[model samples]
Target: MKRRALLSSLAAGSVAALAGCNERGNATTGTTTHDDSTRTTTPTTSDAPTPPDTGLADATTAVFETRDRTISLLGGRRRLPSGLVMRAWLSATATADHPARVTATLTNDTEYETTLRLDEVPPFDTTPHASPGRDYDHTLYLAPTERHGFATTVPAVARAESGGWYLDGPPDRWQPEAVELAPGETLVGEFAVVPERPDSFPPGRYAFGYTDDPLTLSAWQSSQPGPTEESAFEDATPPAFAEQSPAWYHDATPETQAFLRPSAERVDAPAAVEFTLHNHRTEPLSGNVYDWTLYKQVEDDWYHIAPWAIPVPLTPLAPGDTHTWTFHAFSGPSVECENAVALGHLGGGRYAFHVNMSSESGPTHAALFDIDAPAVSVTPTEDVSVEREYRLVRASTPDDGGDRATLVVQRTDDADTRLLPEQVMRPRNRGLRNTLPFFEDGVQKVRLRTTDGVVDDALHGGEPERVFRYDGNAFAAWRA
Candidate 1:
């Protein structure tokens, strides 16, 4: 009976903590211990039971920060016993207009590289809020004390069978990259302290501190490993050009054929383009129809502009089925800045629409559209001449062991066309069956309208199982 009772209490503790409740009492004097980062703060606590001592090394604290504009925590530095020096400060614009941000820096005094994952380190959490993944979850309320309490929640090291103990919330935008700092190298990351809601915190005193454990720190004992391996496409296929003006942009694999053409609307007006994918094979063809973007050509260069379709929460097309994505085409600097030149505000230009469609056979084929549209305004003196030939160059990387293929524009030399930074797909084993790219597939199917059951169940208190195969990059829906 005692064993059963203990198990019950353990389960209850996990549930209450997952619900965003700080199990420790509100800090009255202004110090609390954080198990997430394994550090202790001297904050005063109320008469509630104290949490277990984490036995972390001794650390000192200065005022991490407060609302007073007069003082600054920017240069304040502290050295941990582990030889990691930490520094934190507020941004210049932590005022009412902008959200509060805290920048934390760590310097490794030792000789090796350290792998620190930002997501695993629990930030100082505010309470009296909704669940973490919801829209209103950003509304963090203070504990009416000098120091905020530490959350026991840690990033789930592995996928949870249920949604009860998942670490990722929308606000935890910590880059999942392992921070590997070489000997004497410094690593810096920023965490947001204020909630998006203007009313989350009023003018007040709040002290924030972090835990001792740096997430996934890999100390360099010997010579550190080198940079990640990258390979270029070898044995690339030749450029496939579509028919002349009488036809639209067309390309095909044994299973599917894609056609891209401008809508009947005049080029001078608000423009739209039509993209269709047809399955030519007899068996049911299931390919992730999402993962698409658009780029436009101005003069001699191509720049990324817009998404061809609304990103997916939708379904893929069935065999003998078709999908279409239509949108007002745009063109601008590949990297948008406030002062960047405004090139094609009125629309009408050459565009390249690319989509990645993968199936059980691996990432098979992608669509590349090269189409010319009239300028935003057809001025009498403006010459609408297209000098360059627009073609889609489908290249199969022979070096990648046929695991991946890419679509690029066809340049004059039939060499691989230059692609914007956002255009490159980092090589990875994209063969995972459950991983479906869910960007706009152009076709708005009914199945895509459903919510992810895992997230839905987590927020709504329902049973969450493998209703859909979970993938970090794409959304996979439940199979009927």
Candidate 2:
């Protein structure tokens, strides 16, 4: 019984880890940590971009902002920890149409100059000739240098990234290279990852997102041996990213109750924030990144400090039919400035969050209106009466997602609701596999909240939800 219980608990933890961004909290060992670079306060003569209304407002268009800080380009993953984004675009078919160029530039983001040696090497092996055929997983044409592989060291200053940040090539193409990023300068390089075998494969085929770090054996599943990230809880952490400088904190007392829905007793406060994106524009909405900014209310007009960001490469949000991009961020005073999850999207924008503390490089774009919408609350089921063997409540959604939509089930028999699972179910949209768990004998009020936003394009949508009741035996047949 004890063994089974422990295994069941760990299984649940692992599932929670896989759902959100790859945090050190995923595994019991791997811990990923980053340095906190939030500045105290810079003397600003002028550089603040005023918020503008772009007329793309939906009922979900609530304004939120947070504390601004500096983030490292590399040394970041679960998703790219380094901040340098690498995109892979291939020809439609396996037939080589575009020139294959495998190029890479190592920038020196330091004070001195640096050199980078880009080599095409296989993984290390106990025997001399056996390495190539073993260790590495994917098979493409490439050479090997050095006994093991290739190496380079580039010395440069801060903010210096190499230009043309890419590698272009046909098969037989892995070569290592490096560059120097000068002080306050960046060295970016790019080539083509065009495989020699193009149309021979197929059109609109598999090209990028092949692997997070396929170049090196990064994950244990892939035979890569790097330190994993640390855990969010402190027990089961990830490997590479561990407890670094910029540490985070949390709180659940009365101070933050004014914002988030307060629980009667102490409980976990994890927020499942999803982006309800509808690309109403002509172009296929996407870019090197899909940055989802979660704003906490800070000042009156300034909003709050930025604590959580849903950073991922979103797929091409086809023409119509809204797609929801989901992510989970734990909310407590320790990990945030306040208790609020306001999401925003930055697609095809010129400026990245490239702000420096000392005032050398600062300020970027001033978006007039939000391209994405705010998350709308779904209505609770209504009416309660006794019936047959099973008791239930219908799922309510602006889109009528029906019984399938996943919900964070909160069972409250107490008008003064107290202890219960902070987050019972993860909010997922797999098309109506959802069934609310009810245990009370009398009428029980059940609430179902949508994990993602509702883009009504119109502001006031009447409380953004419906309500229903759950009887002892079955749910009433009704629609909100």
lDDT of 1 by residue, 252-366 (tens): 2222222322333224333344555433222223444565555555556555544323556434443223456554433322223242222233344445555444333533333
Which 10-residue span in candidate 1 carries the lowest summed lDDT? 216-225
What are the per-residue Cα lDDT tens digits for candidate 2 across 117-173? 222111111111111123233322211111111222111111102211111222222
lDDT of each: 0.30, 0.22
Name the weakest run of 10 consecutive residues (lDDT summed) in model 2: 63-72
Cα lDDT for residue 7, model 2?
30
Residue 406 lDDT, candidate 2, scale 0-100: 28
Stretches of candidate 2 exceeding 4 Å from the true structure: 1-106, 115-170, 177-190, 204-282, 286-480
